[model samples]
Target: MVPSAIVTLAVLPLTPNGKLDRNALPAPELASTSGYAAPRGQTETILASIFADVLGLDRVGIHDDFFAIGGHSLLATQVVARAQQELNVQLALRALFEASTVAGLAARLNSSTEIKVSPLLPASRQQPLPLSHGQERLWFVEQLGLSNGGYNVSAAVRLTGKLDVDALSAALSEVVRRHESLRTRFAGRGDSAVQLIDPPWPVVLSPEAVATEDAARQRLVALMQQPFDLAQDRLLRVALLQLSPDMHVLALSIHHIVSDGWSMGVLVGEIETLYAAFCAGRPSPLPELPIQYADYAVWQRRWLEETALQRQLEYWTVQLAGAPGSIELATDRPRPAVPSFRGAVHRLTVDQACTA
Candidate 1:
C-alpha cells in the first residue's frame, strides 16, 4: 500500500545574474535521467509540444517551469497564440503569468477558442520579401548617408575546458540554419534592394591556432575590429581562437539590420544547447522554428503600412516635435562632414547606492 519510489525536492538556486542555475541543482539519482519528464495526460502532452515549439526546446516536462529555461514576454505571447490554435481552448496570457507550467495551464483553460489567425500579410511570402519596419528605418539611414563602417554589433566570450571543435562547428552551423535572418542579405540598392535568403551553408567558424594566450587575445582584438562587407558574406560571422587545448575565445559578429539585442540571446542559447547535445553525440536539442525572421518582416511591413502608420506617426510626432537633433558628446577629434554611425563604447560602473 506504500509507494516505493522516492522523490526529493530542493529549493531552486540562482546564478549571480539572478537566473536559474541548472547545474547547481542536484544530479538525478537515477541510473540515467532526462532533464524532461514525461507528460501525464493528453492535455499535458499538447501543452508540452506548444511550449517546446515556442521556446525552441526539444522537450518539456509537465512540471518544468517555462521562464526557468529562457521564456520571455514575447515568447509568452506565442505560447498563448499557439495554445489557442492547437488546443481549441482560450487561455488568458495571464494564465501563464500565474501558473507558468504545463499542468497549471491545462487546468486553467476555459472560454471559447478562436480559429487560427490568417497569415500576417501572407501574400508577401513570395520573392523579394520586404524588410521589417525596423529594418527599413536602418536601411533608409544607410542609403542616405554613412556609407561605411556603420551599425555593426559584435561581442566575444571565452570558453574553458577541452572543447570538441567539430561539435562546436556543427552547433554553429545548425544555429545559422535555424535562423533565416542570419543567412539573409540585401541584394540590391535604393528602393530596389530586397532581402535575399541564401541557402544554408556552413556558418564558417574561422579557426586560428595561436602560440599563446596573449597571441590569441591580440588576434581576437583584430578580428573584432575588422569591418564587415554587407555584400561579401552572410550577415553573421564567427571566429574561434585556439590559444591552447583547454582555453579559447569565440568572436561572434552580426549586422544590426538582420540582428538585434534580443536575437543575440536567442543565438547564444540555441548554440549552447546544440553544442552540449552534439558533444554527447545526440541530435540537436532545438526544434524547427515555426515562424522565421522573414515572416516577421513581412508581417511588420503589413501592419505598419495598413494598421499602425497613422497611430504611430501621431504619437511620435507630438512626442518628439522640435526636439534637438543631436547631443554633442565630448569628442577627441572634430566630427566628420557627413553623418556617421562610426562609434565607440565607454562603460562606467556606478556605485550600487548611487544606481539605486
Candidate 2:
C-alpha cells in the first residue's frame, strides 16, 4: 500500500528560530485492531510505541511506513541501532526498504532470520579517524540545538560520448585512493566534539546499462529512489549511467559532512582530469589538494573561536529578525512525537510544449 494511506505527513522546515509549528500537523489516526492474519493489535501497538519513542512523534499507526512520513538514511541507521539495543534484534541496514511499515518490520522481527553484515576494511586500516568539515558543521549545528537535517552536496556531469565502464571504474578507484576526504572518518574527542582522521577508502561499485530511452529514464528514477546510507559509512556515493551507445551521465551524492558546493566542483574537476588521463594512458596531472576536508574542520574550530562566530551570530540574528515563527508546510496527517525521516519522492519533467 502507498504511504499516504497509512500516515499522511510532511515535515515543515524550521525557521531561523528552529521551532516547528505544531498546529500545521494533521490529526493522528486510530490503530486498526482487526482484519489481518498477523497479531495486528499487538504488533501495531508495539511498533507504534517504538516509533513514537524513537522518532519524537505523538502517535503512530501500525500501517504507517517509517520512511514515507519523511525518514532519512542516517535516521534509519539510528532506528536500527535502537532496535538492536531495545529489541535485541540485529537489523540489516537495507531492511528498512523492505519492511517500511511498523507492522511489516515487526512481522520481520517475529520471523527469525539472519542478515549478513558487510566486512570492514583491513585491520591495518581499521583505526579511529577524523571528521570532515561538513561533519564538523553538522555536529556544531546539532550542538547549537538545531534539528539534524540531511545535508548533502553532489554534482552531475553530462557525458559527451559512450563511456568506457571498466576504464571509468579504475579511474574512480584511483581518485578515491588519492583524495583523503573520500577516505576519512570521525573520531570522538572528549565530550561532544569529534576529530577528523584519514582512513582507507572502501569503494563499492554498481554499474548497469540502459538499452532504450525509457529504460535509461527508469534507471535514473530508481537510482534517485534508492536512499543513501549515512550510518555505516561516509555519505559519499557515485553512480555512472550508460544512457546510450554515445551518451552517458555521472552522478555523485555525498553527505554534507565531507564537502560543500565549492568542494563538489573541486571533486568533479579532479575526477574528470583523472578519468581523461587514465583514458589516454597518461599519469593524472591534477595538483595535490593542499588540505583535505578534515584539515578544514580543524581550521574551522580555530577560526570560529576568534570572535568571528559572534559576528556571524549577530548577522544571522538581525537578518532573521521579525521573521515568521516557523516555516510551515501542509502535511497529510499528524506528525509522530518522535519524527522519522522516511518519505516518498516524486519526479516531474517538462516536455517541449510544457516548458515553452
Candidate 3:
C-alpha cells in the first residue's frame, strides 16, 4: 500500500564555500520500514523486484512511486529492459511515467503488453534530413559566424588494471554501428543542413604514452579544439592517452550539433557494456535500441502541427512577449557584426558556508 504520508524535508546541499551544489544532493531514500508495505501478490512481487533492482534499493512497496524515490528517465529505460527480459512483456517508457506505482504499472503491463520503438525515418542517403531541435538551434547560431569549437563537448576517463586497447576500439565500433547519431555528419546547402549518417568508420583507440598526466591533459585540450569538417567527416572522435602503463585517460570529443549531454551518457554506457562483452570474447550483449535520434526527429516534425504543440507555442509566445533580442553584457571590445565567440574560462571554488 502507498505510504500514508510523505516526509518532505527542504534541504539543499552546499559546497564548503556555501554555494548551492545542486549536483551534490543525494537521491531520495526509501521510506522507513514501518511505512512501507511489500507486494501483495505474484504480479506485484515480480514488478517490485524489477523496480528495486533498477532503483538500487533493497525493497520496494507496491504503492511506492518510481520517480518519487530517486527514479529518473534513464533508469526508467532500464526498468523497461528488465521487464522485457524477465516478464516477457513490453512496457512503454511513457507507461512507466504514467503508472508510477508498482501495482499501477503491473496492471498496465500484463503478458499481452509489448514494447515498441518509433519507426525509422523514411529517407534515402541522397535525400536531405532535418536536424534535431538541439542541433537546429546550434546550427543557426553557427551560421551567424560563431566558432565551431564552441559546440564541442568532451570528457576524459581514467583507465586502470588491464586496459585492452583492441577490445576498447572494437566496443566503440559496435556502439557507432548501433547508434546512427554517432556516425552522423551535417552537410549544409545554403541555410539548412542535411544530417548524413556515415557508414562504419572505426575509431583508432591506441593510447600514446605521455610523459606525465599533465601532458595528457594538454593533449586532451588540443584534441577538443581540433576543427571538424561537419560537411564531410564524422562529428565524434576518441583518443586514449597513456599517462603511465597502469594509468590511461580516454578522451571523447563530439560536436554539439549532432550530440547532447543525454546522448553522451548513452554513448559512454554503451561503450562500457560493449567493452566488457568484447573483453570476455562474447558478441555484443546490448539489445537493439527501439528508436534513434533520426526517428525522434521525424516524429517531432510529424507532430508539430498538433493542438498540444499549438497551445504550447501560444503559451510561450505570450510568456516571452516583447522580450529583448539580446542582453548587453559589459565588454571591453565593441560588438562585431556577428558574434566572434572569443570566449574564456575562469575557475573558482567557493566556500559553501559563505554561499548558503
Candidate 4:
C-alpha cells in the first residue's frame, strides 16, 4: 500500500537498546483547520453546525474540507442523517462525499426536493430488535459455519510511557456503556434472527507478558483471530501485551457486524479521548449520543418496508436486466459450497519497462 502522508519528526523514538522504536512513532496529522471561513446563509450555517457536531469540532467553516477535518464515510452518513432531520432535505451518502464542504452540500440541498425522514429514536426494550440490512448479510454468512475470523475488525497501538491500567479499564467500560452495539448479542427468531442489548457492565483489559517483540506480535495476532459467539458472547474485546516496563501493545478487536473500518477509526478516537480524561481523574467529557445502534437498526427496518422495498427492487431489476447470473473464473479447484474464508499471498515481479 502507498503511504498517505508523511510526518516530519525532530527525532525518532528509540528503545532502551538504542534501536528504532517503530511502534512508538506518532501517527501522521493529516487534518488541520488552518483557514476559517464563516458560513453566510441559514442553510450553510446549519450544515456547518451539523459537520461540527458530528466531527466533535468547536466549529466548522463553510469552505472546510470534511475529509481533511477527520470526517469519513461513517461520519458522513451521520452528517446526512442529521441534515435530513434538521432541514427535511434528502441527501444521498454519495452526494455528501462528493460535495463534502458546507457550501457545496447546501447548494445540493437547495436544488433537491425536500422529503420526510422518520426520526430515529430508541426502540422499545420489550421487543427484540431486527438486524440492519448490512448486519443481516454478515449473519447469513456466519450461519454457514464458515471461518469467522475474517469478520474481525482490529487495531493496535503502542503506549510508550507509564499507563494507568485502571483508568484504561474504566475507559473501555465507559465506551461499551456508550455504544450499545458492543453490548449486543444475536439470537434466532424462527427462521430469522434479532439483536438483544444487555445493560452496561464492567470490561477487563486482560494482560499478557511477552518475552520478545516477536512474541508480542504473535499474541496480538492470535487475539484478533479469535472468533466470537454471536448468540452469547460480547462483540468487542481489548488486551494489553507487555514487552517491558515502559513498552506495551494495546490490542482491540470487534466483530464486523458491530463495526467497520470507518467505525474503527471513530472508536479509536473516542477511546483516546476517554482514556486521557480518565487518566487525569476527570469525568467523561463526551456528550450523550442522540441515538444508539439499536435505534438505527429499528429505523432501517421500518424504512425498508412497503414502498421503499418495492422501489429498491424495481430499480435493481431494471439495472440488472439481462445480466449474467454469475461469472465464470478459472480456478485451481472448484469453489466450495460453504466458503472457507481463507486467503493466500501471491507475489509477482514486473519489469520496469513494462511498468512504464
lDDT of 3 by residue, 259-300 (tens): 778878878888899899999999999898767777667656
lDDT, candidate 3, at 179: 80
Candidate scoring better on lDDT of 3 and 4: 4
Sorted by lDDT, highest first, which candidate order results?
4, 3, 1, 2
Model 1, 19: alpha-carbon shift in Å?
32
Best candidate according to TM-score: 4
Q: Which numbered prediction scores highest in lDDT against the true structure?
A: 4
Q: Model 3 segments beyond 4 Å from truth?
A: 1-127, 306-333, 338-356
Query: Which of the predicted structures, 1 or 4, would earn the higher lDDT when compared with the native?
Result: 4
Provide C-alpha RMSD values for all models, in order: 12.7, 25.3, 10.9, 12.4
lDDT of each: 0.74, 0.62, 0.78, 0.85
Candidate 1 lDDT over 55-133, as tens digits, reads 7767888777777665777889999888877775545688798888887777665221222233543344566687776
TM-scores for all predictions: 0.58, 0.47, 0.61, 0.68
The superposed Cα distance between candidate 3 and the true structure at residue 184, in angstroms, equals 0.8
Question: RMSD in angstroms, candidate 1?
Answer: 12.7
lDDT of 2 by residue, 1-356 (tens): 33433455566746568887666666545343342232266545666666666666666666666775556677778777766655645577788778877878887877765332222222222433445445656756544433434455656676877576666776677777777667554444664444444455645555557677687666655554444343345556788777666777787776566667887887777777877888888887876555554554444554555535676688899999999999878999988766576779999888999878
Clashing residue pairs in candidate 1 are none
Model 4, runs deviating above 4 Å: 1-85, 89-115, 340-356
- Candidate 1 Cα misplacement greater than 4 A, ranges: 1-125, 144-150, 189-192, 204-206, 314-334, 339-356
